[model samples]
Target: MGKYIVIQGQNIYDVALHIYGAVEGVTDLLVNNESVSFDTDLKAGDELIYSDDYQINKEVTAYYKMHGITPASGEQHVYPKVFSLPKTVEIYTSAKEVGVEFSVSGNGKIELDWGDNSEVQTITLSDKITVFSHLFDSTIGNKRHVSMYMQGHINQLDISGLRPIELYILKSIPIERFVLNNATLSIDSLPMLETAFGVSLDGLKTNDLTPLLELKNLMSLSLTQTIYRQPTIDAYLIGLVRQHDNRRNCKVVMTARPSGEYREPTRDSNSHYRITSGMEAVWVLTHEPAWNEGGIWEFIINETTYKYEQNH
Candidate 1:
């Protein structure tokens, strides 16, 4: 004969008393998905189905473990989640060092891991919110990983007073990837030997990409859903290619739309196309703005050259 525990169709009260050592309310725990109380009883081979809440708890635990992050007191921020910014403000996560700024005031969050066992801080300001800043003073060469969440909104951002190499030093890494969605970016830097690369503006009306001159490590740039007229596109693309050729030997990829339903590619599309010493090659793609179907432009860089003509 096998030992069997019986539920007997009693409410949680009766079952808890019999199976657990004088412990009642075990059934309520099962229904509510609370941690099993110490007194709850169960006989051999007794089984209880898990409630929905149990699954949610398990997922949350898994997320924390994978991302190595936790929530702060009085705040609701989770790791591996994207954040956006509301306004432009200077921050000093590291003393006396300038940080990036956003043009439009809106909600933006950052994936942050402060040095010296500091908990990750995630913040999202409202539309009226502006000037998102942080402080960092990790020992020089101590690298940290920070990410921004832009999601699907169209906005503009700029990183001022930092060269491409300085950026790498700040992050403690060489290869950096930035994501932009329906947004425009303006980087301000003087001519330097180092190279940097990132996505171009989707709807940029500006003629010069001189703001991006010092980014020698630039590899991929996406320009999917911008509202540039044909002439603006031609001028911008030509000028960009020329600039890259003149500075660091880096290859650049320009993307655009050919028709409402067709996509195309343009490589070294400048009038006086000259390959840079570091540039392996240049590629341009013309496609419908992904935003048309609710998608942002994607810039996938396989090179990091910034070649543009002095006059486009």
Candidate 2:
């Protein structure tokens, strides 16, 4: 007989293999730890018992009797075990879509309160990862307050979903870290990034950079893997500096290393002059000269400053 403490990703078979050098001992281990079933999701710090006696523990025998689970006298039963609801759930909403993802440890249904005076929705889920998505109705207003409910026991009961922009306007929450890699952001959605101190739009497929100028509080911005041409990049930088000229003092930081295909600079020489004066400090990430590198650029205009880093 022996006791083992479960670690992350360690299952009953793993414990059996570690203790008895064979997975065939898993049934024996379960019989000793009758409180735990074969389908139980083990967590770290859980205690497990293993032995060669093959005697079913009193707790397990009681559980089987209470649940009316039975098998032939000589056979071992492996059925779905009752589980508690997940401790965490995530909800994401965009302009047109709403998505919810969560884990279910057992068979159950989830109830949702959209908080729009609409009928509550219930969804059945099995033991697995569950994802629910729906098209958002514009009539529901730009903001949505959502609540989730489940039948089983859990640590948290009040979960709400709010739009990124709503969090800023209603709660005065300034977004410090934002990532939109490979996402198509609409002009109307740009306001969500307005108060963000740091933002990444890598692999974005937008043709308009003008909307980004509205991010007056932006400290660091990454446009890596974006589809902006040299002219568009120049225009965006110029516009950003002009908008910030008298509002705040800012600095630009860049690294010397270029990634991606090299491209020619924009044709406007006046734009280059603005880059030199308005740009407090420019760092080039490419092997090319700081002034010629097409990857990253920094500029400061009067009281406004911003740093940009890009990869081909």
Candidate 3:
């Protein structure tokens, strides 16, 4: 059994829908708490008991899967395991200057270990985006391996700025969202990856997407300013979600904003990607025409508002 505390303006039906994905679970809620009936008023902080074996409607799960959004009741969040470190990231680069910028949805701590025998730098993060950078010696010709260890639940990691190096991360962290630009990082690097945004897929032949076809848990992938050699948009988007004989649902975002005079994607500044998977993917490419409205779009998911604005 599980307990749900009532909040302001909540009633038995709200609890039923929240737990079971449908209001029909009201019967089960009423039966479990005989002391409380439909006639009884639900007050703030009132504890209500519910069965653990309750089944969420299949449609709810399908809808979530189509968009790569995981609910609280999903199996991935339920599994438990032991790990030496709860979260870790490894970066393989030869760039003299190495740095990474990312943010967390809540409170957390992230530490970086530069392989060149530098002091381990620590970053304390809040809802505000945090950045950490370290300069490496360009004199060294060999590639250096940098590592990141994290504590607490941080939601998003953006690897922008200078990339084009190998990225290796542990499977324990379960980071569901990522932002990549000019990066040679393998898609298979993160084990629990469910949603990702390929920041810039500009070049066609240069983007070796062989590793992309081998994904497992990916639910959404939006490649901005994309230029692929695929026969058609339909085949390319569907190929992302299909794994040979096994097929799955994945929501993809496509927009057709004209390139700049230099043929680069129009970007007045550092634009934003969907920071969290729970944030709805508004104006998704579902059927027919391949592009969506190219401008600022607003989306509200899970009571949070996120805007995907482009300066076309």
Best by TM-score: 3
Q: Write the per-residue lDDT of candidate 1 for residues 186-291, one digit (tens) a residue.
A: 3232122133244444434333455454564555555545444545444444444444433323333544432221112333556432432211222321122221
User: Distance (Å) between predicted and true CA of 184, model 1?
Assistant: 4.9
Candidates' C-alpha lDDT: 0.34, 0.44, 0.48
Q: What is the lDDT of residue 159 in candidate 2?
A: 14
Candidate 3 lDDT tens digits, 152-233:
6556667554353777667555454566655544545543443332222322223334455545444455554555433333
TM-scores of all models?
A: 0.27, 0.32, 0.43
Model 1 residue 12 CA deviation in Å: 54
Model 2 Cα displacement at 162 (Å)? 13
Winner by TM-score between candidate 3 and candidate 2:
3
When 1 and 2 are scored with lDDT, the better candidate is 2
Assess candidate 1 and give its lDDT: 0.34
Model 3 misplacement above 4 A: 1-87, 98-105, 162-164, 195-220, 231-236, 240-251, 255-312
| lDDT-superior candidate, 2 or 3 | 3
Q: lDDT by residue for model 2 over 198-289, one digit each (tens)? A: 65665565556777677666656666566655555555655654564322223332221222223333335555422331122123212124
